[model samples]
Target: MRPLSRRELGPLTGAAVLALAGCGASEAVPPQSTASAGEGGTTYPLVLRNGDREVRFERAPQRVVSLDQGSTEILLSLGLADRIVGTASWTDPVLDSLAAANEGVPRLADNAPTYEVLLGADPDLVTASFGRHFAEQGGVVTRDRLAETGIASYLSPTDLDDGQSVNGGKKARTTPLTVDSLFQEVRELAQVFDVAQRGEDLVADLQRRAREATEGVDVGGRTVAFWFANLDTPFVAGGKGAASLLATSTGLRNVFADQAEDWPSVSWESVVAADPDVLVLGDLRRDRFPGDRLAAKEEFLRTDPVASVLSAARAQRYVALHGAELNPSIRYVDGLAKLGAWWREHGQDL
Candidate 1:
């Protein structure tokens, strides 16, 4: 991607900021600055506490490899598209507003890139939303391995505190996640890039949009279930992920909030037992799983003997959300806005 002009790098305002809507906190606290501010207000040899690891940056990274779509979008939103050399693990198309900036970046893989490919990109820093991306085994590469090559790495704070197990086990969140988690990530990334002011502006814009979307919208007694991709065993949202944030923000109760895992695979019988008031389905573009597509999920709900009995399915009370939006990312606010609007317009009738 070409270097963003001064105008483009300036604080996003009005519609330009709104257009990006089309696309959480944990064990690791907000990045703690260990040194005084240097030139440009960011001190060199900056140390950021990432989970249990500490990432030090001697200078602003010129080339960054974003290992997940969430991280990639964050970088693009910060006007650091030019700094991104490679991206991977995309679940959906780039946000409409970010497509142009992302066009020039190389995609290392549709999923996780191999260690060799990641290193070949020659990136100074790599960022990922999932800890599995940096796992020692069954992962692309580990943080220690990257450090051996002098390549710095950053993991989302939400994935810290052993909430995310690297052995492909179910992810569990000890504390509930919220949009503030995402804001923290943006702020930390901006600090890393020496663009603290831009981070503040973006955070303020996101906060405003979130407030506007949820203001005075109360669907207190309503309950909902978030269905991600799966057929035999559906992966529904648990208490501590993005779904929890959406539910809490809009005053909707999550049927599966009792489960602590982020996404738990439960039988259709269990879903019927919960019998939520609304079904928030993930409209994913990737077809890696049997029910990855929106239509497939909808079809299963309408045809399956067990699933077809659901009240939400019978009433057609479904809220379709982008798969990316359901994850911990900037688009989560979009999900909140959509859910609140749907509840205001249609939820009362049900």
Candidate 2:
């Protein structure tokens, strides 16, 4: 099977859970920094961070190549779609406005593109979120190898070690993943594109809106729990991950906020014990989601005798939203805005 894109992994894939564990607490700054001063006039050096590897770009990358969805999405949000010469894999369909811009951006190879194809793209920079994408065992395009080919790369901080890994294995590490960290990444990428000023403006706007939305909206002391797809297995979003950010941003109290880290698999019995006020069901059904999916999900929640007793159920307050869209990115602001609107329209003064 092909290595799954983050969204394709879904709630059952356990990839999000693993990714969450890999994520470290937000850092005050990028791991490395540099300014490119030259005729290129871009003055942006690629800054790479995700543990052991670090890099800097000297100019705005003209012929850019992104190897992962998150990095590609970030580039699109920065309005650098024209600069992106190639992509490896894509999850969501490109919006119509940007589809023409992405034309001829080759897929490199099926899953992991080869070095010759990457070099063929003649890109100045190659970016990704996972270290494994850049380097795996067996002749994979290592960062050093790519640099040797005159291309620089980066990995997101979410994949860094930062003392979050346990003896090179998985363990219970509860570091917080903050929106601030994602903002910093955006800033770094903006700098790469020589658009830091624009990035700062966008962040300010998003922060202001998020702050405004959260103002004075009490949840009436009701707590919330996030449900991804499978209710029987009870895949839940934990306190310090993307889901927590959404809940906290929208002024809803996440009942699983106490469960530190990202996606956590819990039992139906656990939901009964917590008896949260509302259930945030992340809509993963791209093809199957309907207007009534929320209602159906709520009905499914009722099957859990433990969850059935919650105040949210009695009032039928279950909410369905696209799951993949909730991750930290430019679109996060859109999600927050929608959530705030929902809370105000249906949840206020409860």
Candidate 3:
């Protein structure tokens, strides 16, 4: 829910608004078909309002370039990997989760690929999990520029319109993401590919699993806290977005459940005040944050005079979560499964 930070954007740094993919959403083009003739504007021109701009896709694109792991993962799940010619991401867990789905896809760069490199790929469609992916990496290559070359661009619903906010604006109108919203995105892709059934089946399965995972779950009685990264103050999963949803599913109450935003910067005192039963950490490499590694976070909690006294820390009740799995994507189900198991195993013990 902490919109992938500008720090995570790496090469696209300094351009915050340019890259957030799901801050807002684009209105869909008209209804679609499996294969429509690319003739008159009638069924050919698929006009969609993505975020703020209107994107028109003359026909289903055969070649797509994905900008980040989230977008790339979604395409692979939709069975659209064959259509992706290039992919680049600051972090990539697709290989671990999707496995063979992206076996042959070329990695363009660790960060955003240069405009020249993108053009050389000759992609018919460009998909990005964040808005920065559409912006100029080295040379200017905005969605408008891509359109000039007859290329279509699509932003995942994860990075939809935020309605002209100063920053990440706000979390989805529906705080913490809902399964329905997730299903809606799957459906949108189905429309984009004109492969309606595949999308529906995927959504239905996800819905069933999510429901079952959370069904009869009542964590309202327990206390949970999520630790993302460190600064002068700690950043926490602020009672919203994917983290909150996962906490609910696992029957653990979020200690930061009062904050309305997805992720928030809270004082160490506040964390101590809440006294969470357990602490969930989003683990990453040493290079990703100032104090980035999982061990570093644990060390801080154990050494900090104030933090060391918390009940969870006293018991060393920490659940390590891969940073990528913490996002609102297909891998989320894995978190649901993991968190549920963690509670069943430790909830009573804690």
Candidate 4:
């Protein structure tokens, strides 16, 4: 699975590793919880809100049905592929090693699995991400409806809550979606499978590598910008999210670190005005690549004038990533390392 690219981490760009809320057997899921489940000796009860419905996991789901790419990645990472009986949408290219296994697991549905297909799968647990992926989005099966059918469900923390505030006190958003959070999710799932030790080992290895990659120089004064796909329509990374976190951890400065929300759209002029020292490029549609990004950057410089004067482009140093990694999951960490490596090679002091 591709990790969230450095370009994806827009605003919440920082060095400190973001932590996932650890759930164990001791953490009893609240009444009408958002997520709940158990496997081996552990239990994962959901504690998240999904619009009007609350999501939850009830027990260790042996017959799992994953509805989102992020959930699929998480399940597969924990060596629980055997538990997954089905999956859906934008997941065709992933888990190549499990090709034969997937052949039998039935594509749950097209972009969004139908309620009938989901019920037919006979899944003990159903996990989804986007609202449309669930019945709540029209005829789609709502989590509550799934529960009524004796199925448990969990929504990725990122998709469950948008870190918005209501009724005064701010509601917590998905537990920090970064490499560290990815590790925690892996660990939590491992516990569900009675493989906590293995989860810890995996996390340790990843963190060790990340630390080595980011060893140290200085970054307080450095400035960078993460550009996703369209250079003409600047979709800048924001603070308090994966892309920004990766940049800061790698010891580079995110130019859009001041942005309020994560992964918000911006303008071409903004890029020119920001004039970041380094700009990270994410996957662009194949047709748009080479021409689109190049033309966009050139045009920006031509019009803004100040843009051409930036050191980042003058040095011809930019990091490009596949679209897959932009999604929040274990792959996000890999993206971080790749970007850090690019920075190190391109004269980033760190």
Candidate 5:
């Protein structure tokens, strides 16, 4: 089957010219409960913390701006689509289940929208999956700046680490990410919206799906390499990121497991040396770089003199996955299911 390109997928927005970046997960810090005694539901002036950063909600946010697709989908899943005034920074199309709900939400930009554009929406709250989106160096606006404007901001707990900058900076994972990290985000967001029950339900559903996907499935530690994008020096998955969670869940070993960065660029020569058993290619629908398209990545592996000789390439062992699935989001379980299914179909033969 031919892989879809960014152009074929249609533009996310007229201004989406840059590629989406990857994020790292941090340890989950339990959100503090400020409810009064005998309170039946979440109370106002709710305090949520991610690492050292915290946002207190006096009331449920009515107008929200989700700065990235991952955060947007989480809100949509929680049945808060009506509250989202605008969204931006997409890597792939919204999940099929969310298409109807997402249809009316305005896409502010393909990548991060300008600070002025984001503020133009008059949002009561803003959320993002990556700290980079709120960082001074790479983000459109700093979280502190948002606070000054009386706008509350929530950065995914998955992106926070203790004593680290809420703005994008080097975050060393004390422990690798797990499904629990994703669950923490859902629960916290649900709490913020005064929808704790919905968050619990969503987490339960994801857990059920994950168990069903890997039930009685084991591949005896087969090695795989996850290639996200960039052809010249491909950004491969590292040990402590979402890819590792997917690999561990499916009983597959990541070839680049030694590297700690979420997505580290490595030489083609190094990839050749690792010679992974399966090449998990990210079928990104973004046109930021040369090999972001699945077809382009596949073609490169087949034609490049150096890459063609790799065992996985020669054997045509490939798994095409959406770029969003490779990141730390609800789609991560989708990636796990795909990998498990692939192994079920081909593991015996290999």
Candidate 6:
């Protein structure tokens, strides 16, 4: 997406400044210089590295707004539903699935809100799943600008750009998307919201589920191609991401597991050469961008110029998964279970 022009930023920036000035210390709580224990014995004035910046939570956020579904779900899982004031996304199906938990939460925007609109919520903290949520392409309120105003932010470890420098010029950690990395986000956020026990408990449960999912699952030497998104060319889940982690649990191997990128685009010729035994089509709805629908993607594989004759396509060995589920978040364990179950039943045939 194209970034907004400087001319577009001037007025919105002014409105945001006004909104910040209007907040009487309630909406704009500055990070404290000292740390102390708070609710449920969670340490306060907590400082942690989230994505590319240092975030300090002086106290539990009063008016929290989730900038994406991943953060929204994480907040809810930690029993912070009452703390959330606003949410924005491109029709997050995960939030939709947890509709009862998210009932009455303010729907801020279908995508990232403008600076004026974001500030109107009087939010103390804005949590996001991806760096793009704070991207200039989205609108005003970049993390640095928000920090100057004492409003804090967070970015999921999985969402930071791999090449970007974070926290004292260290390159961002953006690979081998494992369950521990996902749970670390939960534990870290749990600390942020003063819900350490709940976070630990969730992490333990996910750990147990993942263990059980992988236990006794035989791969039968069937390599898989986790097709993330594409129309003509396939944008695949490379070896170092969530898809590969899930594949490990199911005893299957990822054909694209030799790359450094978390998710890498590959030619169908590569797919042909790899000759994966199974396919995992990530089903994405066309909410914001024109997403590649599951049905359409399957059809393309069966009828396209190159993909039509691929072994995985002809065999019809596809494990359909929600695009959102594959994102490194609370649902990662669910992904393990889903793939484990599907492959156990279907993958045994080949």
Please report the candidate that would top lDDT against the real structure. Answer: 5
Ranking by TM-score: 5, 1, 6, 3, 2, 4
Model 6 — which ten-residue stretch has the worst lDDT? Answer: 14-23
User: Which scores greater on lDDT, model 5 or model 6?
Assistant: 5
Worst 10 residues of 1 by lDDT: 14-23
Candidate numbers sorted by lDDT from highest down: 5, 1, 6, 3, 2, 4
Q: lDDT: which is higher, 3 or 4?
A: 3
Q: Higher-TM-score candidate among 3 and 5?
A: 5
Each prediction's Cα RMSD? 9.3, 10.0, 8.7, 11.1, 10.2, 7.0
lDDT of 1 by residue, 1-350 (tens): 78643224322211111101001221222344334564347875566766655676656878889999999999999899999999999889999999999999999999999988887787778899888888776788877666655677888765654534421334666777767768889999999888888889889988888899998898976899999989999999998887778888888889999888888899999999999999999999998889999999999989999999999999999999998889889888788889988988897687
Give the per-residue lDDT of model 3 (tens digit) for 237-324: 8665667777766677888877765567888899999898888887764355554568888888889899889998889988887655
Q: Which digits, one per residue and each the tens of the lDDT, describe model 6 over residues 220-286? A: 6678888877665677887776677777767788888887566667788889888888888887765
CA displacement after TM-score superposition, residue 263 of candidate 3 (Å): 2.8
Q: Rate the local accuracy (lDDT) of all candidates.
A: 0.80, 0.60, 0.66, 0.57, 0.81, 0.69
Question: Which pairs clash in the backbone of model 2?
Answer: 44-57, 45-56, 45-57, 45-58, 46-56, 46-57, 272-306
Model with the higher lDDT, candidate 4 or 6: 6
Q: Residue 178 in model 5: shift from native, Å?
A: 1.7
TM per candidate comes to 0.87, 0.68, 0.77, 0.66, 0.87, 0.81
Q: Which residue ranges in model 1 land beyond 4 Å of their true spot? A: 1-40, 162-170
Number of clashing residue pairs, candidate 3: 22
